[model samples]
Target: MNAQFDIRSDSTQISFEASDNAQLSRLLDEIARNEALPAPAPENVFVGDGDYRAIGLEYLGHFVHIGGLKPTHRVLDIGCGIGRMAVPLTQFLDPKTGTYEGVDPVNEGIEWCVQNIASAHPNFRFCRLDVAHELYNPGGTMAGDQVALPFAGNSFDFIAMVSVATHLPAKEITAYAREVMRLLAPGGRLFLTAFLVDAEDLSRPTARPRFIKGEEDGTWIADPAAPLGAIGFDNGVVQDILKRSGLDIQRVSFGHWRGIGSTHYQDIIIAVKPE
Candidate 1:
């Protein structure tokens, strides 16, 4: 399915849009034909870690069962690395009604997704955001706070940021929270994961990936030299940010990162914009 799509950009943001319905039909047919293909080997995984296809499948269930994702919802995938979540979603979302927009700072991931995932699913589009991070995009020209995402206000019915906040500082998290609130439609849901620590957890001696640095601003880093490498925020700070962003916190499921038997490695937060 060689569908043509438009890539648009302005000073602050860049976007991809699919304009061909016939291309979508062909893509869906191709997907149906290859539904039984085996998952990729772990050695071939590049963007993050673990088996790429398995991780994507795992998160797809999380999105549907925990985040209330619908087949027809318009989704905004923040930090969509190499189409991990998008790949599994193609099987679930309705081609005619559901749409996906992914944004990430990593150029390679975005480029790979455009070539691999977007070509197979026209409704799935990817964009690169040139935002700076200590680990991911050091050469990025813009700070996370300064970025104005290209999408219109209240555009997406669901917004996801899996494993994203764990790498961002307090200021960037706040900025992204506001952006999520702005981009989400009224009553839309926001699903994200982060490393969360409470005062009691901090005092414990056996805390996993002990965050011993930068507790002044409710943000802690496992490594002081590389603050963005692995970060944990105080639970209260996360609550405050979402509340200030005008999102109502619905649930926060603590993950196994702190040595508890949870469903994931990072805390899952579900919030909804008020109607």
Candidate 2:
């Protein structure tokens, strides 16, 4: 099944066209001067260990140069923890046109973003879902696959799920892909990051997390006792899921996590919904 799809091993430097380069530069300058931008979330409230400001800036560049994000495009950010991605966009997205909607299972992060980020930028909104996750929200009422995201169909121009898939089981991943397909407007783009592994990558000694256990459904995990702690899917499994969800695979940039020389830490998959 994977042989049918063209997944590129991209190792090129991150560069934007002249116009985009200029736009990114302008946005960066604005972000630097904007003293009103919310301060970084406190250590306890921040979800991930990565430097909050640096990762946000880095991925903001990726959204522009790789995801083709425009100032006027509506964006949906899944697993938006403590507004790491939203803080940078407050300077770039047009107040009248571009709007951002972020949803996550962790209540603390969502609350922080609502009070700090959304209070200042009215167009930016955050919602906490009661979705259950073994590592993040174990006592929630809803299963990850069962939650119907609160949004209209074909609503967003750009959707991103950074570091979200790496923590989900296979079924939830499929459910989220289907929802992403439904939420994205026709011709809209999906920028997703995941820990994708092929058989050869599994044999490499330097592959981060080093998935040692295999599930019956072909998903791989770093720890069998805590499957959702760090999950990986076979390259084919991800391709099949996206294809089944009616998304056209545009590109796949392998990440440095697997000892590969790439720009990102997790593999990036860019796809589009056909018009």
Best lDDT among the predictions, by candidate number: 2
lDDT of 2 at 44: 58
Task: Write candidate 2's Cα lDDT for 1-275 as tens digits.
Answer: 11111111112112223245764665565565555567654665545677776678789888877887777789999999788898887766767678999999888888888988888788899998889998889999998887679999999999999989888877888899999999999999999988888888977788888887567567788888988777898886776788899999998889988987877888989999999
TM-score of each: 0.82, 0.88
For all candidates in order, the CA lDDT equals: 0.77, 0.81
Poorest stretch of ten by lDDT in candidate 2: 1-10
Highest TM-score: which candidate?
2
Over 4 Å off, model 2? 1-18, 29-36
Error of 2 at 15 (Å): 19
For model 2 the TM-score comes to: 0.88
The deviation in Å at residue 255 for candidate 2 is: 0.4
Query: Clashes in model 2: which pairs?
Result: none
> How does residue 36 of candidate 2 score in lDDT?
57
